[model samples]
Target: MEGSCKMKRRLLMFTLVICSFFIAGVVSADEDILLQQLIEETPTGGILELEDKTYTGNIAISKPITIIGKEGTSIEGGGTGNVIEIRSDGVTLDTLAISGSGMSRSSQEEHSGVRVMANDAILTNLTITNSFHGIFLNKSKNTRMSNITVVGHGANQLGTQGNGIHIMRSSENYIDNSYLEKTRDGIYVEYSHNNFIDNNTMTDTRYGLHYMYSNYNSFKENNFIKNVGGAAIMHSDHIHLEDNKFSFNQGSRSFGLLIQTSRDIHVLNNEFHLNQRGLYLEQSTSNRIEGNDFFQNEIGIELWTSSTSHVFIKNHFNKNKVHALTVGGESNNDWFENGVGNYWNMPLLDLNQDGIGDDPLEYSSSLSELVEENELAYLFLASPAITIYEKANDLLTQHKVMAFDKYPIMSERKPINVASVGVGIILAGVGVYVYRRRALR
Candidate 1:
């Protein structure tokens, strides 16, 4: 009788498990179909509010509409294609957690968490992960995306991972207040122009921001840290970069900012620190690199031969191992305009108190000469022997000047941040009040 009872119990447990599996399958299928049905039933220009639950992906919006999601709403791809595809203009997607885009099934094709091919769309408050491409804008115009957080495949798989935000042939768009990490490039823009990117943070990617064949884009107030390259502006013209921070981008051939084959770029009031190279220019012309700060970099500025017609004024170079290394960069560039040149963290005689150095800054180095003559010397860079040699050469040799900066500014004037001061004073007052209360107690 005991054996019979045990067998019956085992049969009952197996049946329950089977029933649960069958019910789960049914529910998943039902939800997917119901979601599609609901979307189909919703009229154009209507709103489809999603529940705080997971929904199967491969959804497409072909009409002008808005989709609002609850706090925990998610759309997960079925590992076949993009999670969401927007095809019509005036669409809006907000407050959605999206992930699991299909892997590259072909060499020429890949999927994205959200693919926007429409114009005048607004996407906000999104959290996306495991995205092949987190968000893709293809020929989209006047689109705005803000408060987006994306995490891509690991950087170690860079060769296979797609970009965090890919904009191709898209123009006149805005991306603000976004955070992206571990993608191929944090925000890759190609043939996209008149875009505004502000107040974004990108890290652990190939580049925090990348531009190729794009023009008239503004990148401002962005934080780029721990990427291979903080930003790479290449083959673009008439771009503006201002008030950005690039830091801790340390690796081979890495730079806080790299401008290559670009022209008419305005790099102003930016900070570059703790990088392999602070600012690198290659084959670029007619750019304004002014009011910037370079600190704690291996090389503050590196100019290749073909880059010319640049203006460098009111910038500060401090605590860098080498201030500027030029390889045939006798650009006849204007280092001083309006009686003002850059401030170098070096000793200079400012006798007249006019805030100008009596002696001009002649950036010529035996180390630079050696690297130019033999590129292999760069491999031994930062070695103690190399450092010793460089110091000895600087002390002993008559170096040939590679670049010159006349009317060098001997002073650095930093603007006071009022908000920071106010915050500090409030914090101090609160601390004192707490101390007094504790003493009374």
Candidate 2:
């Protein structure tokens, strides 16, 4: 009986050893096929259709070639360096899953899933994960990055992780249909110009979209949600921000949009809601803000003393904690343009049949500044004493006017457009019918 048991134990140990060797062999075989080798062997302008396999190595494409891969094609770095590096223009990489890049604090270290030093390149349908930076472009122009998804490891420590898409000194690039989460800055642009960032969702980052010294860019239909800071545009100009949604960016110093030291920015048709400060402008000038909705924010617009020539037209401010406030003295910015002004939730009496209110809207209050200066004075809010005091100060003191909308529009309770309502109902009915038909089929 003892000899039989010993023989059985020996057989089990031998079988386990053979299985380990087999698994190791399979793994080695996969690692042996380096993507760099294949790229180097292929001629310039060649098209390489990668097989459905996991290539474990760093790759560098120095020539102009196109590398395409299907589903399940992965390029996993060994946690040592970038997964792919493109040095020549006209290089295209599509439909590849990349991960496991080296982490570094230095920007010169080049620790990214994909680093593009080339111009006029196209990167589409690529998914990057666990990388220090998903895509880092340095001085690369006319690059198009579309339908890219970047999932980070959620590292909040500074310099440990990088932006989902970092554009540095690049121009005329387009980033569209991308989703970025848990990165430092979802899309960071520095010294870049003439870029179009549209149809992207950036959430849970330090800043959803951060721009520093970037100009002539248009951001349309992008969603910035639940970020520490929603969108920070600093020292830039000629920016067109249209149809973007900035919401739920709540923090001590969080803002829906922070425009600092920038000029000639057009913020049109954007939604800024549920933020600590809807729009915090510091030394920003000559910007045209029109057709925006500022709702449920702590401060609708916090204008610094240096902000000037800002034209606010046809905006809707509803239920904001404070309609508008200034840091120091009152701002000298224009609130009305082209015979149109914002709709402030205030008491207005338009005796005439015209849509414009007869009286100008006082969008700021000296009483609010008093409450800020003296905290105990907040108790006087809604008290007749405060109102009397403000009136007395306005008459006797030379207090600077905060903001005046001479041509303020009527309240949102105005009659709805019948044409718009009928069109909306018809569109809703058609959408429901199509959805039901698709479900049935």
Could you list the CA RMSD of all candidates, in the order they appear?
13.0, 13.3
What's model 2's TM-score?
A: 0.79
* Clashes per model (N, Cα, C within 3 A): 0, 0
Per-residue CA lDDT of model 1 for 186-282, tens digit only, reads: 9999999999999999999999999999999999999999999999999999999999999999887788999999999999999999888899999
Indicate which candidate wins on lDDT.
Answer: 1
Q: Which candidate wins on TM-score?
A: 1
**Candidate 2 RMSD to the correct structure:** 13.3
Worst 10 residues of 2 by lDDT: 23-32
Q: What is the lDDT of residue 391 in candidate 1?
A: 75
Candidate 2: list runs displaced more than 4 Å.
1-32, 366-401, 412-441
In model 1, the Cα lDDT at residue 304 comes to 79
Residue 405, candidate 1: how far off, in angstroms? 1.5
Model 1 spans with C-alpha error above 4 angstroms: 1-33, 105-108, 373-379, 414-441
TM values, all candidates: 0.84, 0.79
